[model samples]
Target chain A: AQKVTQAQTEISVVEKEDVTLDCVYETRDTTYYLFWYKQPPSGELVFLIRRNSFDEQNEISGRYSWNFQKSTSSFNFTITASQVVDSAVYFCALSQWGAQKLVFGQGTRLTINP
Target chain B: EAGVTQFPSHSVIEKGQTVTLRCDPISGHDNLYWYRRVMGKEIKFLLHFVKESKQDESGMPNNRFLAERTGGTYSTLKVQPAELEDSGVYFCASSQVGVSSYEQYFGPGTRLTVT
Candidate 1:
């Protein structure tokens, strides 16, 4: 069974604070994909990042960064200098290579205070 | 390009009632998928469609749920005699078939409330 776990149910932080959202996954497949999606109050799920199993290199895009560690089975996301606009429900998902289905984690709701 | 879209942004129905939800995928996207997130639970896969054919239906909870993609352009998911437990946000996503990076584009989900 493939599963993504996001232990944090919710988190609150002041604007400009850096916050990290943790994600741990369990999968037997050696090659799989990990993803992060953001769901705003509007209810649209926006894709944030997708990382492949073979590539454990960390990624940084503007204020967003992702740390993929295969040894720990973790793919954590970090938002630096967060803004109020960053408030949303974030989901971590896992899928095996060539599988169209995604197994999602219970989302973590992050609230940024202005 | 327009993203995937789902109809009946929100629906409220009585238990045992029938409800139909529709999804229009982005143009040229051949792969469509359905997922649902029940309150307090992780989002789970419902089914998948490749054009007009069902690629995978293993995730469908029960026979009460039926999905159809007639012309391969739009799809419909119908729930007959819906149970209270069936209430959730139903999301539709689409991706191009054979794309190496199979990142699906999602729609604004339909919230179904069964009372």
Candidate 2:
């Protein structure tokens, strides 16, 4: 059974604050993929990042960074200096190598007040 | 290139009413997928299609839901008799073959309301 757990249901933070969203996954396959997506109030899912199992290197993009620690089965996302535009629901998902379907977590609703 | 597109941005129907949702995948992409998020819960996989061929549909809840991608261009999901539990956002996504990246492009989901 492949599952992704996002423990935080919601988080509220003031603008310019840093926030981290935790994601833990369970999968039997040795090779798999992890992804993060952001759904803004506008209702479109924006692709943020994707990490493969073999790549353990942490990724940083602009004000956003991801810490992938396969030892703990965790891939956490952090937003530095958050802004009101960063308010959205973030989702963590897992996928098998050949499988086309994505197993998504319950998602975390984030609100950044200006 | 146009992204994936779903018809009927919002729909309100009775519990026993039938509703059909359409999805047009990105051009030149062979992989199309259907997923749904019900009652603010986790988004779940419903099915996958590759060039009009049903690849995997293990996530489909029941027979009340029917999906088809004729000629492999546009797809449709029809609920013969929708249940109250079917109320949620239906999302459509597409990805290119051999992209090993496992990245999927999504559309602005369709919100279905069953009363």
The lDDT of each candidate is 0.95, 0.94
| CAPRI quality level assigned to candidate 1 from its DockQ score | medium
CAPRI band of model 2?
medium
- lDDT score of model 1? 0.95
What tens-digit string does per-residue lDDT give for candidate 1 at A1-114? 998999999999999999999999999999999999999998978988888899999999999999999999999999999999999999999999989799999999999999
Task: Provide the lowest-lDDT 10-residue window in model 2 chain B.
Answer: B95-104
Give model 2's DockQ, 2 decimals: 0.80
Per-residue CA lDDT of candidate 2, range B22-74, in tens?
A: 99989988999999999868999999999899999999999999999999999
The single-chain TM-score for chain B of candidate 1 is 0.97
lDDT of 1 at B55: 92
- Tens digits of lDDT, candidate 1, B44-80: 9999999999999999999999999998999999999
> Can you write out model 2's per-residue Cα lDDT over A7-90, one digit (the tens) per residue?
999999999999999999999999989999999987777889999899999999999999999999999999999999999999
Model 1 chain A scores worst on lDDT over the 10 consecutive residues at A43-52
